[model samples]
Target: MTGTPGTRTGRVRVLIVDDEPALTEVLSVAVTEAGWHPYPAADGQSALRVARGCAPHAVVLDGMLPDLDGIQVLRRLRYENPELPVLMLTARDALEYRIDGLANGADDYVTKPFSLEEVVLRLRGLLRRSGAERTRADDPVRVLGPLVLTARTREVHRDGAPVTLTAKEFDLLSLLMEHPRQVLSKAQILDHVWSSSFDGGGNLVEVYISSLRRKLDRGRAPMIHTVRGLGYAIRPVEDGR
Candidate 1:
């Protein structure tokens, strides 16, 4: 899953730099699975060149590079993009080795032979803490089965038919569509879709949900379902499992 060099609009960008092709591929795959684009570079020069254009939201930098040292690369990266989140991958687990990477500029350090999932989680945590995801460009249009929603336009379509909605309706539908097949509780929906100072009860969510159901399921099988007293979830019409 190699990505072209440069910043990707409306997508979270992750740069994976490792001299080993196998390791770089593994990291890139994991990063892609996390729902972000992965840009792979094999050496320090390549990483810097890619970063110059990639403007990566986060970086997974290996401790050893064939050309420049990992710390040196990290230094150059920080110099350019000071706020870029970096997780250094070191083959050595020694205290001094770990300290050196962190002391320079690494936001975090991961030892080699590390769990692939751990590296992804570390990168996610770094992004969250750094507030990068929140500042990312508008979400690209999201598609799920016959349902399609465009964030930039705030428009939703069902079965190729347009559906008009209020501001609140659009927000609620967008949230559900963001996590299709995942149940979101009334409280959760209220917090995300409505204002925090919104004193309205869960009934507000129920009303909006009812409106969405009427608009989306008027002539189709129920795509939105309620899990007893749990919460509401949206799925593709044919995705019954």
Candidate 2:
């Protein structure tokens, strides 16, 4: 299950970390069924070793490990690959744990009594996002309403005024504007904007959307609209439809 990055050529390498052998087997089966290559590790140290050697695109990490706590393992993984998308699976059902996981750079979190289907979906979303970002790297510019994004220059302007954004913020805005008026599901936004390798469970997406609204729609008619239970969309707000 271990191979050089890109050596396999058509599938994404995913590191599945869990101390439970049965669960690990089930997850490996699911991952394989979903067309991803799964590399399983039974402990934190082994997880890091596998990750470093193979360079997986994403990781499915269990919260409790025999050697190192899941969070600590995640920290070490992040250090090795800062941008690696990690999904935390834990038996702990606490708000603080989820918050702490997200703060420490986990892209997604799932409780132990979770759906295998959901994990598959999340992983697919992450891969698609990462692929789309790579394919769309050369797309130069996109404009929506009065907002404009120039990918080559890495610049943004709203209503003819310069607007500064962090690199990630700009990428998020670019994705939204690229498909104006279309209601992008949280998964879609997460995949396209955040590189699909990380989910962060919509919180990261929400935070970025809020920041975009504040900076890009200030004193304006509000182009960013939350679609209530769906996701977010960016388009001109009609004056009095």
Candidate 3:
């Protein structure tokens, strides 16, 4: 769908990949009601084909499918379009399963029986953040200690060099930097970075945090820290050593 310039006028394009026909129809109607164009796919192969042709802004993927699994679909999508955001849906609640999905490139995953309003809200948030990033293509780079995130090029740098980050990692870091020194709850992080469809019981956020720490804290002092039972925050190391 076409969007008007300088105004939030266009419908966000969304691809719904689910084997259940009933679920797909319900989701399509919900997405349309939420101001997005929903494209339905009943299997992995069809999803891939539609993704290639539609180039949707984001995808809502179900874990179970007839042919290829959701994680596999996510991997292939990442290979084809690294920046494409995806919200995974599954009935599985196991931590290992959640980690596997995230490792395979899913930005977020929602458990079965999720509310339609929740899903639509999450999609809108993800689309809003994505749209904002596109609009800031000419803005100055944001520096946080040894870390540098360029809004213009969608690039992240460490010290004086470049660093490659998955789409979700960058989004997480961006959200943290935007609220530096302020602790943010896992739910807030998921809503801002992965979309509201996330439902992995905070494990998804933990895994991404671990990945970010490895990349952003290799040689430098740690900046990302967990606040005990509260949440997480990013700031300069306080020891002053």
* Local accuracy of candidate 3 as per-residue lDDT tens digits, 1-241: 1111111222355789998988998898888777666767889998887665445678999998999989889999899988888888999989898899988888777888899988887777776767733543333445454455665567776543567899989889888877767899998998888776867849999999999999888777888889988899987554232
User: Per-residue alpha-carbon lDDT of model 1 for 115-136, expressed as tens digits?
Assistant: 9999988999999998877866
Hey, what RMSD does candidate 1 come out at?
A: 12.6
- Full-model lDDT, candidate 1: 0.81
Quick one: ranking by TM-score, best first? 1, 2, 3
| Model 3 segments more than 4 A misplaced | 1-10, 132-241
* Candidate 2 local Cα displacement, residue 187, angstroms: 52
| Model 2 lDDT tens row, 98-166 | 999999989888997988999999887776766622443343645454455666787776544678899
Inter-residue clash pairs, candidate 3? 122-196
Better of 1 and 3 by lDDT: 1
Window of ten residues with lowest summed lDDT in model 2: 1-10
lDDT of each: 0.81, 0.76, 0.75
